[model samples]
Target: MEPRDTATRYDQIARWWQSQHQNSSYGIAQLKRAIQFTAQRYLALDVGCGSSGRFINVLLQHGFEAEGLDISREMIQLAKEQHPGTTFYTEDICCWIPPKSYSLISAWDSTFHLPLNQQEPVTKKLCNALEPGGVLIFTCGGGSINGEISGSFQGQDFDYSTLGVDAFLQILTEQHCTCRHLEYDQYPENHVYIIAQKCDRSTSTTPN
Candidate 1:
């Protein structure tokens, strides 16, 4: 499904999601692990931040000025209510532009929802939007090929896609990022997460 369609679908269950994840530890541990690699805490972003405000809270607690972006109006609305002063956007990441460089960016379980064809460019955009030495943490369906799949959650049918491990690593290299870590966090499930840090091309080297 398109990001817009997924946004509408999430709107149908935004409140449900908020209630379910209010205290969930699902991605909290993983996010913390990713945060440890970043040396700067000036600015961070939570793309596809749902209504729970979980990731945003963590970022703020760590001294970063955090902003959120999600395509769902309902999700963004509830997020605003939970964190009044924090900035949140109601735009698709595929088309939304980053206003400034970030010290860290977390996509978590969000970017997997993008259309397959948009993955490469969007990934590159995110990497380019990072400051030198900035880190990016994101999840994807683990594999060695590119593909799409549909699944149901919260009574809503949603779609997910992946560029697979190799391709994603390739993009990171091309964007002057070094893959810091990669893992199949959920071994039985095809869930994979990657931690990448952008390097100063002038003083850094991309692996051959």
Candidate 2:
């Protein structure tokens, strides 16, 4: 399915999403781990950021000027209302150009919804959008081979795709970013998260 179709699907359940996750602690620890790798907290972007504003709140609390983007208009509307002072973009990730580089970009449970072929290019795009010392934190279905699967959330069906672990590592290397951490956080479910940092030539190549 196209990204806009996913947006439409999410639009149909925006409030249900917020109501379910508004007070949840779901990605907090992982997000904070990614935050520590960023050398500068100047700017952060939450991609595929839904209506809950959970990640946005974390970014702001960590002292970054945060922005959020989602393809769903309803999701962006609620996010804008909840985070009135922050910038929100309602656009497709594949078609939208980042206006500026970010120090920390969190895709969280997003990105995997892209059509299979768009996976590598979008990962490259996000890697390119990072500053020299920036960090990218994102989630993907884990395995050694590329694949796509269907899943349901809040009664709405959705698709997820991944380029697999090796491809992701190769892409990060090709983009000049180093994979700082990769974990199958939900062991049996294949839910994996990765933290990668853009190499900083002026400093040591490892996260402090």
Candidate 3:
């Protein structure tokens, strides 16, 4: 499901995704955990924020000023409409440069969509984008190796890839983040999530 037109595919479903999100609690639950783990309620970034602005809203409610980025222009448009005063970017996370360091960064269900090859590097960039003691929370398609999986959503094909559990932990550790929580609690579905905290540079370990 590595469609040549990823952005367009999501654009086609932007409204549908937004409408359906109202009844979903998945994002909210993850955000609650992210907030609990975050040391500061300063600035937060929601990578791959879809039209719903669910994560962004949660950040705001908990005292963080939030901004978002999504690969789909239509999704960004819808998010802007839903959250008039918030900033939302339409750029692929794999190539985008984070504008500022954040105390909280939540990729949630988004980063798994990046190709397997981009996982480590992009993740490292994300870790570097965090301020000391900042928290990073994201989900991955649980597995032991690198690979891709395809699925159809609302009749459109989409792809998900991962660098596996071990690789993910290694990358985070190399970026000087401590793995605080890694849960496959949503087992049987290949869904795994992790909450990691950036260590203060003074006490950080240099990756060999």
Candidate 4:
């Protein structure tokens, strides 16, 4: 699907997104791990942040300055209501420019919305927005490219055309980001969790 079309589709489902994952234990665990792994009191940005502000709240609770951005205005509004003190903007992840480098960038379950062709550029932009030692934590839908899978949520059929773990790792490596940690085991129903650190440009030959 086109990027705008994907944004519209998500906007239409924003109200129901939180409810769909209200009882997800795995989701909870993933968020907790992301927050714990951040381990920085510096500012953080949550890209493609949906309606649920659980991760944002966790960051704030741990004394990190947190903000979020999403393509869906409806999701942004819901996030604003849940986190009035924090900032939330309606912005496309592909082209959004953050005002300052963040200590951490979190993209939980949201990167799956990007078409495979757009992932590399977006990942590169995200790397540019990270501070010297910043970390990027994200999850991608897990499946072989040729696999067929479908699920229903909010009266719409959700399909998976995911990149295999190896292919996904190649994208990161090509972007000049090293994968410090990765886990993708629960196949057919799994998502890849990745933690990549931004290498210091001054100390290294490349700009991360």
Candidate 5:
């Protein structure tokens, strides 16, 4: 799908997302782990942050300056209402230029929406936004590229071109980031969680 179409898709689903996932056990557990794994109290950007703002709230509670950007205006508005103390913007993740470096950057389930062709550049930008030893946590379905799935909220799709644990590690390594931790397991619903840390230059070397 084209970029604008993708944004519109999420915009259509924003309200349903807030209502359905607000009390999701899986969602809460993931946010909790993300907060606990953050190594420093610095700026963080929640890319594709949906209406719930659960992860952003967790970051704020842990003393991090958190900001969120989502393609859906409806989602951003809801997030603002729920989290007035934090900043929320209605912008596409692929086009949004983060204002400053972050110690932690999370994409959550949002990355799966990007077309396979756009994933690499977006991943590179996400890595560049991180501080020397920053962390990036995200999740995706475990599978190969497939056709779109239309549902009540919107048309959902999967592009494994940028999915899976090994592909995630390769992207980080090529970006001069280190893989400090990785966990691969299919939850009951077959989602995979992949977490990695940007390497500290004092310890990692870049190619000349």
Candidate 6:
């Protein structure tokens, strides 16, 4: 099935997703890494934010004024109710353009669901959306090369795809982002995450 199809499926299960993820720790590691790498907390964007405001809440705790974007209208609606003060948009990250740059961006386990063909372009766009010295945290399949796969979520099948490490590095490099950290967050699982920072004109690399 096409990756875009997940939007409809997610819309149908928005509440179920919110219930499951409300108290989850699956993305805590990535969020912590982002918080560490982000020096400024002016603004943050959460892509594919699902129906839970958990990450948005964390960003607020870190002093960031946060916003979110998701493809599912149902998900956005649920998130808006949970986070009335935080802005949330219903748009596909594959084609959505940021109105302004962000100090920090988190895709968590979201971007991997984009079509394989759209992965690289979207990655590059997201990297470009970063303000100078901005931090971007995202996840991808921990495979050695570019590929796609199918997975079942709550009995419904969905597609997951990635441009892999090589393409990711290339996009980061082209966008002048320093790869700060990368790891298979769930070691036994294929869940890989990365923390990268857009280079400030004065600094060639992120601080160690």
As for TM-score, the candidate ahead, 3 or 4, is 3
Overall lDDT per candidate, in order of appearance: 0.93, 0.93, 0.87, 0.73, 0.73, 0.88
**TM-score of decoy 4:** 0.81
Better of 2 and 4 by lDDT: 2
Runs with alpha carbons beyond 4 Å of true place in candidate 6: 1-3, 205-208
Off by over 4 Å in 1: 201-208
**TM-scores for all predictions:** 0.96, 0.96, 0.93, 0.81, 0.83, 0.95
TM-score of 6: 0.95
Clashing pairs in 4: none
Quote the lDDT for 39 in model 2.
90
lDDT of 4 by residue, 126-187 (tens): 87787876788887766555243456666665544456667767767766667778777355
Q: Cα RMSD (Å) per model?
A: 2.1, 2.5, 2.6, 3.7, 3.4, 2.5
Q: Which structure is stronger by TM-score: 1 or 5? A: 1
Residue pairs in steric clash, candidate 1?
A: none
User: On TM-score, who's better, 2 or 6?
Assistant: 2
Off by over 4 Å in 2: 204-208
lDDT of 5 by residue, 11-92 (tens): 7777888887676654556556755665676998888888987778777878889999888788888889888988777887
Given candidate 4, what's the lDDT at residue 194?
A: 79
Local accuracy of candidate 6 as per-residue lDDT tens digits, 11-100: 889999899988888788679877898767899999999998889989888899999999989999999999998888889887798898
Error of 1 at 176 (Å): 0.6
Model 6: clashing residue pairs?
none
lDDT of 3 by residue, 1-208 (tens): 3322678899999999999884568768877987898777788999989898888878898999899999999899999987899978888888898889999999988888887778888899999999999999999988998889888989888889999899899999898899998999677878999999999766567889
The clash tally of candidate 2 reads: 0
Q: TM-score for candidate 5, please give it.
A: 0.83
Q: Give the local distance difference test score of model 4.
A: 0.73
Candidate 3 whole-model C-alpha lDDT, 0 to 1: 0.87
Model 5 pairs whose backbones collide? none
